[model samples]
Target chain A: MRCEKSGRIEVSNLCKRFHKAGKDPLQVLQNCTLTIEPGKLNVLIGPSGCGKSTLANILAGYDSPDSGEITIDGSPLKGPGTDRLMVFQETALWPWMTVMENVIFGPTVRGEMSKKEAREEATRILELVGLQDFKDKYPAQLSGGMQRRAELARALINRPKVMIMDEPFRGLDDLTRELMQEYYLKIFEKTNCTTLFITTELEEAIFLADRILIMTFLPGRIKTIIDVDLPRPRNYHVLTSKKYLQIKAEALEYLIEEGRKCFGEDCNIANTMVDEFRRQADNRH
Target chain B: MNIYFVLPLFVILSFIFFIFYRQQKRLAHYSGISTLSQIKKTLTSQRFWLVILGFVLTIGFWYAAVYWLPFDAFHRLPGPDEVVIEWLSRDPYYGISIYTKEYYVHILYSTYRATVSFLLATILGVPFGLLMGWSRRFYEYSFPLVEMIRPIPPLAWVPLSILMLPGVEPAVIFVTFLVAFFVTTLNTLLGVQSIDQAYFRAALCLGASSKEILYDVVIPGSLPYIFTGLQISMGAAWFSLVAGEMIAAQYGLGYLIWQGYSLVKYPTIIIGMVTLGFIGYGSSAVIRYVGKRLMAWREQELGGLGVTYEE
Candidate 1:
């Protein structure tokens, strides 16, 4: 897309395990490997609880992989830095701070930029996120979608090379979710920063990504990677287009296969998913 | 000595009231209302009279129980009128009343000891709590001591405090301090623990330093619980203060009550109890007032109910 993002992230053979005190060690991410090209949007799609979030956390340097090497632009990616920022699913905008304060929290704490300069930068970024009107309101006072926008504003102000978002709009209502997806796509095209978005929503994955990585069930491994070759400035109308339906069907098949493997006596989750995908496939915008 | 303590208290109180009055006036003007009329209306309201009536009936029951009870079970109890009569008269009796310098001296001494002890507890305990909450090593080092010491009543420390400190006054203050200190430390620790993990992760991703985390995350995050702890600590401070006063002090409401008990001048005991009740209530009110001021964020977040614990 010819963007200005400066870092290339290479996560090779990443393996992570969580140990419980009185039980067997549980493996989460297994031999996960991927390279996120700079200035591109890459979405990781998988079933719920499939370690996509754990992978995102590792990539963002919030947690270390038990066995792996992560490199950013050929240099070893260190623990959390200004180079990588995360927007949490729950929108972790500091409740104690106004939107403006949350946006400037990074630079203010680091003192890398002067207070006035940070304030100016924060204001600019908040305006871009369409949160200029809510600059004085605390996160508690904002709606769920507004809170997500505020979080996006906070992350953007840091000017990170890679922004990792874990199900950033998962909790919004259906209407808000659709609007947020459109809004997010617009923001991503402008910033053109490398973004790795983790979500189970297949439609969201297709809409946001230049590349999509599908993962298997628990002990999650990268099943396959598909490139979304849709033209730029793709809107909601593209959902009805033939090429998008073909891609959506392909993604759905991969997900149904994975979902079936996790089925139990009580949970017909896979069958339900298949039916839902079919209904969505039939109902064109 | 009475004048020295009483003078600053008057000055400080007047200054506070002056600020409060100005704020009230400014707010009233902004709202297009008069403060005096509003206050007068509030004073004359049904709710106000109901509260007054409730108080009189409750006290009337106490007086009736003392005067008209059939047995000697309530013999030591004095009617409210008896306490009032003693208050208005001179006390070779060593009671709380406007008539005596001795009463003021006792009140001032108790206030001083309580103030010094409570301040020390907060200063020492809060940081200790933060350390324990923030670092695993600190929790390991101190948690066991806290777990052991916290459950034991502050009164239990009275004998040990008497042995440890050189003077009676210091011992008494030490006991009171222990009660408040433990409350602040434990509550501050819980506040830190209760903070969402997402905030810490978000701050780390933003490249915040450990020091920044302490101030921005730990302090603000734990503040709600810290305030809850302050209320508990203040109550404990009063409890320990009265216990120490009764046991070791030459003057105080507690000492007066004890003296009245020993002499069987029962109305002085009622005066001491009533005075302690007022002071305890006052101290707790002050803590809550400070809490409300510092936690204005929570007040707005919860829409002013001050009781919601849900995230």
Candidate 2:
């Protein structure tokens, strides 16, 4: 079900710093190199306050890195463009536009298609997101889940080469978030657009990623990369499978160790998760 | 009862028709209610009843107070009935009287000045303010001048305006326009500034050009503020119009008020005051109506309140 049109992304030693007028410079990202294969879902998971968001912003061309480069389809990115659309953590669907208007905004703005073609594309995407009924509703009029779906519809309509989702389901209730993760997997399978999905949730990463990148907090660094070899044509039922649990356990181990290092003993996930990682790391040593 | 009340009554009548028309439009989709019942429903609503009661009780109290109070007491603010009676009679000292064409002429000139000035302020200020908000350089360039000029009262411009402008009409309009224009420009600027940065970022990532962002993000995003500015501008126009006309106008509601005061005709002044009230209320109401129409998304956000007849 992978798409033929998906594009590869290369992040080479990306570094970014935030300088304050009267304060010491803060390093948000440093030496962060990652590769998201074409036609694959690469989930980047990290702890809160990690520089994942900064990296995502840099990749999306919303912000420039102090140093290093991001290339899509082997070409250096110029700036924010339709070719690389970023679905924001918060619902970024224009409240002023109805769902239909939000979906077609990219094509219309880019003059990428004829009027009839744009309409057809909008209809197809809205239907793909199961939002045809609510296409005329304002983002305010929609439920949280529907708004997320609408935002996804808005992003996918542009056929972005590298779809960078910044915790796209972070704010949803647990049930809806899980449902959205499944829904996104369905869309990802179809589009197969090289995705650099950022999240703080381990299971969400396990649920959607072909490869998972665990990042350190603050001066964000990719500490570990685990290939989720769990069988595809996947669903929530796979949560009970041994392979899924093993992968989840491995991700938790790395996340817990990184969480402990960055947050000291303060992180609850580290408190709960590091014992297992300690045992694993201790046994390895 | 008198001809002076005619225009005010006409305004109220049109206001009532507007309410009824809006109600009818909403009810058109409801199959359960007959058209007659829908009219009854609209008239009998709590808001409608409250409005009617408010007007009736206030007017009734004013009539009683004016009638019973001795002319010596409270310096004799004339009653509605006296204003109505004087409005009908032909005595220039006691009443404007239906026979006088002066009342209509004053009203016509005042309206013309206020309307022209108001239109000019709106056409000039809104875009300038929006640009100021949209672009940092524009804001930095113009904001200082706007701030420096904003505090100068419209009345303070009178002598300088009279000397600079060719005619009294233009001078008065200049003063009125200053007030409306300042309110409009500032509010439009606030509207643009109030827009969340996320909206601009979203627009940029979606491949919108700067022009498209202005149309889709900056403008529509700032509409609630724009309309609010317009409404405040409407009020400021009427406010400065009275002051402007009182200073230099040959004829206007402001002139009537001034002429009445100089001539010791309290009833004529009250009529002019009441006319000004009606005009201010009607203009703001029109602006609110237009705001409601342009901002359906806002209406949806605020749970459809203020945008509908019903809660």
Candidate 3:
């Protein structure tokens, strides 16, 4: 999906740094350059503490890069706008609103339509997400999967030019994750939206993305961008296909090499120590 | 015993009537004549009448309590009839006059001072709390002072207010404000602090300005706590009013109650106390009603936090 003539974006160099307690300053991102074309799902894949979420935040205009420019349609982006509506990793639907109300939030706030029209659009999107029956139910009443669906409905309801999803399906069970992946493909097909979806899950990236951006750990930079040439209308059955496995292996190889570089040989040993400390704390509680 | 049942019966009947009324209105609306007469016709029904009758019966019970209840130690309560009669025929020698309607007059004064002082506290305390909660520098500088001031009783401030202010009016207002200040401030701060950071990020993502973020997400999200503060501060202000007016003030309910106690006019004291209780409850009910309407989104959360009542 990379445009040859005039594409959607031009990122020169992005850098970010954070101050740490009792230590040297931590560099989270440095001189990362990546350009995304319009109407393609660009999945950013990496391990924990790899600044992938930070990158997503920068792209969504929630965070600014320390230095470097992100230009969309050949113009530098300033801050977050309805132009790039983000679906958060944690379903950030207003806990107070019903499923339908959450979906209509953008249109209502932007004054795009009358209240009645916004509600109609919300209802239509809820139906599209297969959540028509749960329109009046609050977020607490919904399961995590349904809550994610409601967030998706909310994101899609606005019909934004670029839909930014930040690991929206990370915590779900396997069955629900597969179902949501399928749903994502369907909605992407319908909207023709340029999406930047972030996830740590390799299989998920291969399944739904047009091109996957594999990022290296801390001070994150793009290691590779693997294009998925598999046919559309993808489902869980595609997991068994040879093309899917090949994409997964390529992503995993980059991830494994990055993981080794970032966390030396003692990663698992340190994690086990931390896990024991947490277990003791839990017992005390 | 039977009369006690009247209130709940009234509520249930009203509930049923409302449902029926809604159904009929829905029917009329579907048929496409959105006229006032049609809506009114649907509203006027047998169920509505039954509910009204039940409500009237509960009022009758209160009236009866005023008349029939014996004023001996066994009951230790005067009926509304006796209180009314005594109120009407009080001795002129005791500053009693028609215009004075001393009881109602005192009620008016108490209500005016409490409401004014409480409103001042809300305006000042909420923003202070917001600053204290939002910025670490503000919190570090302010929290210790607030902590020290909060536990001090309103009575403790009486000496200072009386010395500092020009008259009893300012003194009373000062005491009332001091009583409400810390609670309102603390609650507002907590309310602001307790809001999830993700909400701010989301608001930022939506291109909300700092002021817009504070108003839309922060204030609305923290309203339940603010209302909880209002509820508490209202009660504190009422309690403080009695002590506040007990100073050089001549015409407030607190003064009236104190005067009644000095003269051994037990009924007048009872009247004053009862009037204060009613005003306090009434004001709190108003706060609760407004809280319910504004924090309509937080009803479930507030309910879970043990503020539940059957609607």
* TM-scores (chain A) of the candidates: 0.91, 0.92, 0.88
Which lDDT tens digits does candidate 2 get at residues B81-145?
A: 77766766566566575458887888788888888988999999999899899788989999999
Strongest candidate by DockQ: 2
Lowest summed lDDT window (length 10), candidate 1 chain A: A261-270
**Which docking band does candidate 2 fall into?**
acceptable
The model with the greatest TM-score is 2
Which stretches of candidate 2 lie above 4 Å from their native place?
A: A266-285, B1-53, B67-73, B88-100, B305-311
TM-score of model number 1: 0.86
Query: Candidate 1 lDDT, tens digit per residue, A141-237?
Result: 7777888988998888878888888899997989999999999898888889888888889989998899999999878898999999988888998
C-alpha lDDT (0 to 100) for residue B256 of candidate 2:
87
- In candidate 2, position B85 carries an lDDT of 64
Q: When superposed on Cα atoms, how far off is each prediction in RMSD?
A: 5.3, 4.2, 10.8
**Candidate 3 regions off by >4 Å?**
A1-7, A96-101, A107-120, A133-137, A266-285, B1-109, B119-153, B156-167, B209-215, B251-253, B260-282, B302-311
Predicted structure 3: clash tally:
2
